[model samples]
Target: MKFAATVRAAALCTAVALLPATTAGYAQVEARVSPEFARLFATYQRIKTSYVDQVDDEALIRGAIDGMLASLDPHSSYLDGTALQRLNTMIDGNYQGLGISVQMEDGAVKVISPFRGSPAEQAGVAAGDYITHIDGRLIYGLEIDQAVEQMRGPAGSAIELTIFRPGRDNSFDVTVTRGVIELEPVTSELIDGNIGHIMVNEFSADVGSDVRNALRDLQGQATGRLTGLVLDLRRNPGGSLDEAVALSDLFLSDGQIVSQRGRNRQDTIVYESETVYRGDVAEGLPIIVLIDEGSASASEIVAGALQDHHRALVMGERSFGKGSVQTLLPLTRDSALKLTTARYYTPSGRSVQEGGIEPDIRVPQLSDPDAERRQRLAMRESDLRGHLVNEAGVQDEALERDRLDDPRFQLTAAQLEEQGVTDFQLDYAVRTLRRTAGTVASR
Candidate 1:
C-alpha cells in the first residue's frame, strides 16, 4: 500500500529532526531503512489483505514500525503514546513508579540492582532475581522494554510480579504500589578507610551539579580530604550525553575530552572540554572508576574519556559496549524512533564501539563466576570489536603490559573467573593512590 510508503517517508523526516546530533560532529543526514525494517514493511502490507479478520492499516504500520525499531538496539524500542511519555519521564530520573532497575540478559528480564531506598528495594527486590511474569502474563520472550512497560502503572496503582531468585527454587511474587523516584543521581558513602565513594547511578541533566554538591558534602564531613574517590559506574546504564561530557570535564583541565564520528566524517564534530576545569584542586587526586558489564552508553563515554585521558583509572572488567549515540525522533501521538546517529570516541580518537573500554587493571566482579569470562573471547558480528579508538593516531600510549598475574592482586581479569574477591584489587588501587600522594607530598 502507498500508505505504508507514505508513513515511512513522513516518519523519516520527522525522525531526523527529532534526533540528537550524537557528539557534536556529524548530525544524522539521513535515516536508513534497515534491511529488517524493509522486510517487515513488506510483510505488514501483505498481512493487511490476507488476514482472516479485517486488519487496520494504521495498526499494521505501527506494529511493523515497533518491531523494526526493537530489532536495532535493545534499549531503543517501541513505546506507544502513553508508554513513550512514561519512558521519557523515567529517563528524566523523576518518574513516579515502583522504582527498580532491570536488564535483558541471556533472554530473561533480570533485576540488576535496586536503587537504595527505592520502592522496589523496600518491597524486597534483589539482584539476580528473574521476572517471570508481570501481573499474570508470561513475559518470557518479550523485548526488555516491553517487560519494563508492563511494570509501569499510575503512581498509586499496585502491580504484582512473580520473581525467580537464584537461591530460591520456587517463583515468589511481590505486589508493590508505585511511588515517585525523584532522588538525585549522585549519592555518596564513607566506605572502608575514609574512602569517599560517589555512586553516579545515571547521568541526568542535574548530575554535574549533584556530583559537585556530593563531593563538597563529603569533604566537609571528613577530618581532612577523603583518601580516594570510587566513582562507581557499575550497573549504571547511561543517561544524558551532555551529562557525560560535563562529568568528564569536571575532572579534566585542558585535554581533548571526547569526540564523535560516523559516516567517515572526521572533522565534522569534536567536543573538547568546555570552559570547565578542576579548579577544586583535588581533581587529580587518586580516583578509581568502578565499571562492569552494565556500564554503557554515556556511562562508557565518561569512563572512556577519563581512562584515555588518564584523568581517572578504570578498575573493573570491560564496560558494556554501548557507545553509539541515539537521539529520540518524535512522531505522531508520542511515538518516536530512537535512531543510532554516531559512535563516540575518547579524546585520543579511540572508538568504544563493540569492544568497550577495558580497565587499566581488569577487576572482574568476584561476586559472580558465570559473569566473568575466564577466557572471554571478546566480540561478535554486531558488537564493536576493538579496544582502541585512535590507536594508530594517538600521541600518548599506554605501555603497561597486561598484569594477568600478580601475587598482591586477587581479582585480576583472568582470576575473577577462578576466584571471587575484588578486595585485593580495590586495596591495590588505594595503596597506589596513597603512595602517589606521599610521593607528591615528598616532592
Candidate 2:
C-alpha cells in the first residue's frame, strides 16, 4: 500500500496493448452528501456568508467543492465540470496536448519526461526539460499545476512551447501539435530465441488474467520449458493493489506477500500468497523482475515480495520507494479523496516509503551515455534500506545487498544505452534464469 500504489500501478496496468480499466466502488452510494457532513458544509457556509465583500457565488461553491474532495484523499478529489471532462480525456489515453507528464519543481513548471513517440519527444523533449514560455507568455513564475492547465486544449490544436533544456542557455521554441497519446500497458513477443518477454508498462485491471493468457500464449509457441521469463517493470508506474497481489500469486505460493498498517489499531491488513499458485503446474519456474524509479507501488510489492521470499531475482536500481497507500475515498458529486490511508511492508516487514526496497543485486539503468548525464545521477549506497513501503523494522537485511557494482548483476542501463537496446535489464534477467535453469525448490 504505497503512496502512489494506485496511481503508479495504474500506469503499469496500462497493458492495454494487452489490457483496459478505472476506480470506483459502492455504487449504491449516491453522489450527494448527507446532513452528517457538517464539518465541511458548515465551513463552506461560514466562508460564503462571513467573507468580506460579496464573494463570487461560483468561486465560493468551487472552493467548497475543492475542500470536500481534498479531505477525502490525495487521489480522490473534486474536478470541476470542465476539469472532469479533461480528466476523462486523459484517462482515455488520448488527448490533444503536449505529451508530457509534468510536476512542480522548485516553484517552476518542469517537465518530468515526454511520453515516448509523442509530439514532444519527436520535438526532442527530454525527461528533465523545463518550460519557460507558453505561447510567448513567460511561464517561469507559474506553478506546475497551473502550467499544465495552460498546456491542454482541444484536439488537433497546436501549442508553441519555449523549453529551457537542461545544460543549455539559449531557450528554443518547439511547436507541437496536440495529438492523442496512447499509453501502452503490456508489450510481449519472443526475444533471444524462444524466450517470451512481457514488458509490462504497468499493471491495470484484469492484468492478472492477461498475464496468464500471455504466458499461456507464449508457452504454446515455445518448445523448451519456457527457457526464461523476463518481466520488464522499468519505468512501470504500479497500479491496483489487488492486481499487485493477484499478480504475485501468479508466481508465488504459501507465504506472506505484503502487509499494511494504518495509524489506527484496527486498520492493519496482511496480504498472503496463496498455497495453491496457479494450479502449481508452473512450479519451480524461474521469475526475474525488472524494476526502476518508475517501477513503484504494486510493482515494488511484486518485486519485494518475490525477492524477500526468495521466489525471484530482482534486478535494477533501488525502486521508486512509494510504499504509502492512498485510497480514493469518494465524496458527493463526481469527486473523491485519494487519502494516504496505510503504509505497506514486504513479507519480511520492511517499509518502502522514504527508502525503497534494496534489490538483491542492483543494476542501474542509465538513460544517457554522455558524461554530463552521469553527473546528474547518483545511486547512493546509503539510500538502500529494508523497508518495503512504509512499515519499519528489520526483516531480511542479510539476504541480499543493494550491490550496484556487484559482478553477479551485469548489463546495466548504461550498457543498454550504449548498445541502443533498453531491454538489457530484461536480457540480464533472462540470462540469470538461463543460468539458474530448472525448478526452484520452494523455501
User: Could you say which candidate leads in lDDT?
Assistant: 1
Cα lDDT tens digits for candidate 1, 283-361 = 5467888876557777788888878777677887666566676666556556666665566778877776656677877
Positional deviation of 243 in candidate 2, in angstroms? 1.2
lDDT per residue for candidate 2 within 1-443, as digits (tens), equals 21232343344234212211111111112124355545544554566578787766566555655555444433334444455555555545667777776644444565544655677778766555668888999877563446888888765888899977555657788888877677565667766545667766556666666777788888888876576677766655566787788778888767788898878777788887773255433566766777765566778888888888787777776665667676643333554444666778889887777566666666654444421332234221123232222235334453224422455435545666677676455656666676776756222
Error of 2 at 286 (Å): 1.7
Q: List the residue pairs that clash in candidate 1.
A: 25-269, 349-389, 349-390, 350-389, 350-390, 351-389, 354-383, 354-384, 355-384
lDDT of each: 0.63, 0.61
- Clash counts per candidate, in order, are 9, 39
Worst 10 residues of 1 by lDDT: 1-10
Clash count in backbone of candidate 1: 9
The per-residue C-alpha lDDT of model 1 at residue 115 equals 65
Model 1 segments beyond 4 Å from truth?
Answer: 1-11, 14-46, 102-113, 121-130, 143-146, 153-179, 191-194, 264-267, 277-281, 367-436, 439-443
